[model samples]
Target: MHTPASMVTGIVFAPLGLVLVFTAAITPQWREGQARLGASGPGSPLRSGAKGQGKGGARPASAGALLLLRSDGLWESCLQVENSELKQCWPVAGSYRRDPRVRLAQGFILTSLFLCGTGIMLACIGVRCWTDTPLRGVAATGGLLVVIAGLLSLTALSVYTHNLPRLGMADPSKAIKSARFPRLSLHPAGSLYFGWLGSCLQMLGGSALLFSFKRPAYPDCPSCLKLRVCPACRPCPEIPNRPDNDVYEVSC
Candidate 1:
């Protein structure tokens, strides 16, 4: 059986989208910020003797005006000193985890992943190329699920983006609150871009699959199935000449 072009497109792009979204979800770079610390200031974030702070459990800080980088994701957070190998990572907790927006993003993204995975399985089963006629309806149903998953992912991304700066605001350890260097800012990071791209690809793939719902036109031939005849190559039968004057035959 010849596979429809749309089905092939959906098969290719949907998996790629799924991979990208999964990568984004597992990564800890959803949002990142850098704060410059002063070694000499009493309120310095990285002061040698200062207590540990933030959702990521703290380790020792380098004694300098070095930049402190923080990254946050759905499940984990990481912190590192600029240009240094000293890094600490931990699962997301505290007020940040409890935040409504964070919880919403987490739920939406997780659900999206689950739905997309299930949809892909359905699509694979429906794309039975060995059969004479493919299950276009089943394939289309999968496509709809994939499309919904993409939308959910997109919603998660949007919520996280619009509330990026406010996500970890409850953390008292933020350098922005420090008087020494108060200009620290947080912004969307690499993972968000990956998610956005994946969402787009998912939508495109699902739409392509949806097109398969339309039936293809074929020439009328009773033996065409067994002969595996191409519609274009199959010739129509000619009408037989009749001897009866009253008898009439007409081709529509």
Candidate 2:
């Protein structure tokens, strides 16, 4: 099998993309939120009366300064206090798991990652240079799988982006109003950007592998000549003797 340069390059890219996507999937930075606290409330430890009060009993300036929330994924959430350098994380709530958009995004992203892994394995098998013949069909199928994976990831990212605002905001429709945090705004994080980039790479690598499916052209034979023969029974032509060379030429 003839392995084209494009296929080799695609093989490299497919695995790299898979790694990035996998990393993004595991790392909790898909979405980020920052809220400025105005004086800590019931659940917060940064209350004014707690620790280190001045002689005049004035509130510390950094008491309600910065609160950071980061999500590694739909499953986990993290909180960080900027001023005190305190950090905490916990599993996502059942309400978040019940949300349709969040569930869809998680499903799609996970499926895409699975497909990418399968496609990369298939591509590796198909593009083996040691084989007598290249597995064009297998490689093409792998490329198709990779393309589908990219599409799935893109869909998940799009859905997440579209619902980001609503996801961040406190929902009045839910019964658990007190459970939701107030005055917090969310934004896309580095991991979300990495996921987007990984999807693009998967698509590009798949396309390149697809392009490698072209069949090699056969070279024309100089020895064979095209001849117009009668529709009736055709007879072989007599050989012509060559004086200079011992070779004889025959026509059909």
Candidate 3:
């Protein structure tokens, strides 16, 4: 049995892509930023209401304050103070989880994972190297599914990235006042880079697999060199003799 080159490429790329995507989904570094904690630093008695603080305390200066590193992911968020053991993490909740873009991203990523898994299974079954010929249609179908899954993941990443800062900003009233909220600038993090790369690999693998839809070319016959014939149309080694008494008529 001969395996198509595309099948091999797909087999190699699809699994790597799946691994990366899964890793990104489980990690909590989609977006990250550092917050200069002033009076809101840990153990501060004035942590609750910075709004009531006098002008002196309301300053957003970072002197003698801890820098809190915050990170957000599809499932959870984490915060840790630089050069300190203080760390906190929790599942996404409140307005963050309820945000339309966040919910869509979650759904899209889940669906993409499921579909990609199913497609990989189908591809494995279809790429039956033990058989004389591969199941081209089945392999192509799996490829299509994988391509769609990649597209879904790409969409989810795009939505999340484009609205990273606005994800949990549905309620403006809940936002910390500028005076108290330290200088926090968010940016795409490691997990997002992983996801983008994974999605690209998925698309490339699926596209390669899609080539399986075309029939494999047949090798030229040894008896008649340079002449090619499809397997189904090739002449058999032996032809049964027709009865001499029977007359046959042929029409073009």
Give lDDT per model, in order: 0.79, 0.69, 0.78
TM-score of 2: 0.75
Off by over 4 Å in 2: 40-45, 48-66, 70-72, 168-170, 173-181, 221-252
| TM-scores of all candidate predictions against the true structure | 0.78, 0.75, 0.79
> Which scores greater on lDDT, model 1 or model 3?
1
Which 10 consecutive positions of candidate 2 have the poorest summed lDDT? 227-236
lDDT of 3 by residue, 42-161 (tens): 655335434343333443234445467989999999987665445789998889889999999999999989988888888888888776567878887888888998999999999999
Which candidate leads in lDDT? 1
Total clashing pairs in model 1:
0
What shift in Å separates residue 242 of candidate 1 from its native position after superposition?
18
Worst 10 residues of 3 by lDDT: 243-252
Residue pair clashes in candidate 1: none
Tens-digit lDDT track for model 2 on 1-252? 446777887798877887877777777788887766544556654554334443345534465443445554666777865545457878766666567887898899899999988888888878777854567778877887898898998898889888876763345565444422454567788888888889989998887778757754443223323333222223223332345433223221
Candidate 2: residue 88 Cα off by (Å): 1.2
- The lDDT of model 1 is 0.79
lDDT of 3 at 78: 95
The residue-by-residue lDDT of candidate 1 on 79-195, one tens digit each, is 887755568999998888998999999999999989888888878877887765678888988888899999999999999999898886766674344456555588889999999
| 147: Cα error in model 1, Å | 0.3
Indicate which candidate wins on TM-score.
3
**lDDT head-to-head 1 vs 2, winner:** 1
